[model samples]
Target: MIETINSSKQAIALEDKYGAHNYHPLPVVLSKGEGVFLWDVEGKKYYDFLSAYSAVNQGHCHPRIKNALVEQAGTLTLTSRAFHNDVLGPFEKYITEYFGFDKVLPMNTGAEGVETAIKIARKWGYEVKGVDENKATIVVAENNFHGRTSTIISFSSDENARKNFGPYTPGFIKIPYDNIKALEEALEEENVVAFLVEPIQGEAGVYTPADDYLRKVSEVCKSKNVLFIADEIQTGIARTGSLLAVCGNCTCEGHCEKQDTYTKPDMLILGKAISGGFYPVSAVLADDHIMNVIRPGQHGSTFGGNPLGAKVAMTALEVVRDEKLALNARKLGKLFRIRMQKLVDTYKILKLVRGKGLLNAVVVNDTEKGSTAWDMCIALKDNGLLAKPTHGNIIRFAPPLVMTEEQLHECCDIIEKVVREFEK
Candidate 1:
């Protein structure tokens, strides 16, 4: 066996020497993870507050998901879309029935799922809605974090993501995220294909929209003959208190369509927690009317519907429902905010806390360029809880959904102590 690297210094040196400088990560070097906790190379344990950007919502190395992955790996791994795999059809059926969609097209990552949705919407516009070729425009929100692909980044408003990344793809319209008026106005424009948005803008510091935002937007899109696409990769699979943030208080463990609270979208894009972070698995779901627009030859990925990923995704989703993670997240999330709100009221450095379910952020009352949030995160890590700052002054806190109420209280205590100490 290769010699075990026990020192954080050695691991950090290896990454710095061999890896690309794309990410500026927290100083701690993690070695193991399970449920809501992570251990560093130096054998230090810390509460996992970020949950791998919500991909580990089912928790790291969940036993059932792991068993599925291992068993499937022993049997079959990759058999591309060129050939049929035994698990693909079953997995596809399971997901459609679970989410109440007619069909699902699997991809490998969240970005690919979003790209697939875009392509389908554009094609549907031309073939079904009668929009002129190359004139189809998809509406998006400001500060959206879809992915780093050339086509996806083309419409991003972030200077860091958009700057120097041109010539960008066209046929996209940017609008204010939560502004129903702006969305309606954009829909008025000719050849509008779809309105794509995250139910809760998780990357934009857990920005929750107004209560009626999703419902109203769905109504607007339906009225205007524009497809309403929900990018629920980060907020879906029980991460946002429900199966999806778009589910809108629907507590049913089964199909979302049956529930009165559910606001059905034209296209549902999903990834991240789909495989419980066991493997890369993402999918786009829609009814036959919209999904049938894309001919087989027009779009496909080599590893899109592989058996291994399919098996993992199916088991992962079962865990979400069987464990009632949505319900758990909903309960713990409220308690987290209630506790964090007390800290916010006491401390001058914290601005406020806002989010749905386990997805939450506490904004720092400091300038964007200031180091207060980052400094606090360092302090948090030192105090045995792991969290990181986003966009300079926003610290996102999204622990795994597998955490119990008692564990949540413990994590809250750790966070409270860190904040109090930082203030002092």
Candidate 2:
């Protein structure tokens, strides 16, 4: 084993020497985390603003989720899909019922969950929808960030993700987000099986669509006999005000089928906080009619429904409900925006504040090539908060759902101070 490093400088040097340069992370080298706070290597404390891209929504190293993972690990870890594991059945049933879906297909990561949905949609198109063989198309939004997988990145409009990533996969049509007319036009194309989209475009700088965007799109897809697939990996599980961003204004303790406010997608893709950042867990939920298309042996993963992950996911979801994270996010998100809006009014450098729930962002008055947002983020970090710029000019600020109002207020103070003090 390698010798322990004591300083942030040592850690950074090691990463530069050994790790791939794919990511440009903030300079801080974090060593510990709790509910809404993180501690760097030198013991500098700061509020966690990003939540690991919304993966740690339930909070960092949540105790209940940790206990569940440890307990399951001590008993059984991986009994793979080759055989039935006790935890998998219960977890599947629990998740299906919890999300108001007929079935759940477990996966190990958000990208894999998205990939599974695509495969399911394609198979359903060929078998049930009677689409021509090898001619099915799935329409996606222009500025979407579904995943970095070869097929998922194929339809990306962002050159940074798509450049040199091909010979790209085909059968995907791109359309502008929040455009009902564009969605309608895309549906007109023959053999269109699904419209895969994020409820709120997280990686696209927390771009929230119109209030009724999902409902209208669902109606259009329903009329066109196409599946409405919602990629809620970052925005689901109480990260948004509701359990799912597509749930709209419904903040009920659990998903309510009676409430029409919830724009239920035909397929819901969930990940990230599904295990409360304790384990890599994700799932695709669908009704039997669409899910039944995939027979046994058609698709499976070695560690998809492992007992350890299942237990962690079950407990993680329980934490979301039991701790009332959705209600907390709704309450604090309003206050957060109000506070940020004040900064927007005072600071000419800030263009606007936009987002629903804690998944929010502020647009800097700078070109994409400029470094204003990045500089402000570094300032915020130095002043005891951690956030990062998304698409250059936009910096996303998403804290854990378990954060208290008082802690949120403190973070807002740090943000305001950073903005007011930023020169460039």
- The numbered model that scores best in TM-score is 2
What's model 1's lDDT at 281? 94
lDDT of 1 by residue, 110-176 (tens): 9999999999999999999999999999999999989889999998877888798899999999999
Top candidate by lDDT: 2
True lDDT of residue 265, candidate 2: 96
Question: lDDT values of the candidates?
Answer: 0.92, 0.93
Candidate 2 per-residue lDDT over residues 1-424, each given as its tens digit: 9869899999999999999999999999999999999999999999999999999999998988888888888999997788988999999999999999999999999999999999999999999999988999999998999889999889988898889979999999999999999999999999999999999999998888998899999999999999999999999998888999989989796778788879999999999999999889999999999999999999989999999999999999999999999999999999999999998998899999999889999999999889989998989999999999988999999999999999999999888888878844
| Candidate 2 residue 60 C-alpha distance from true site, Å | 0.8
Clashing pairs in 1: none
Residue pairs with colliding backbones in model 2 are none
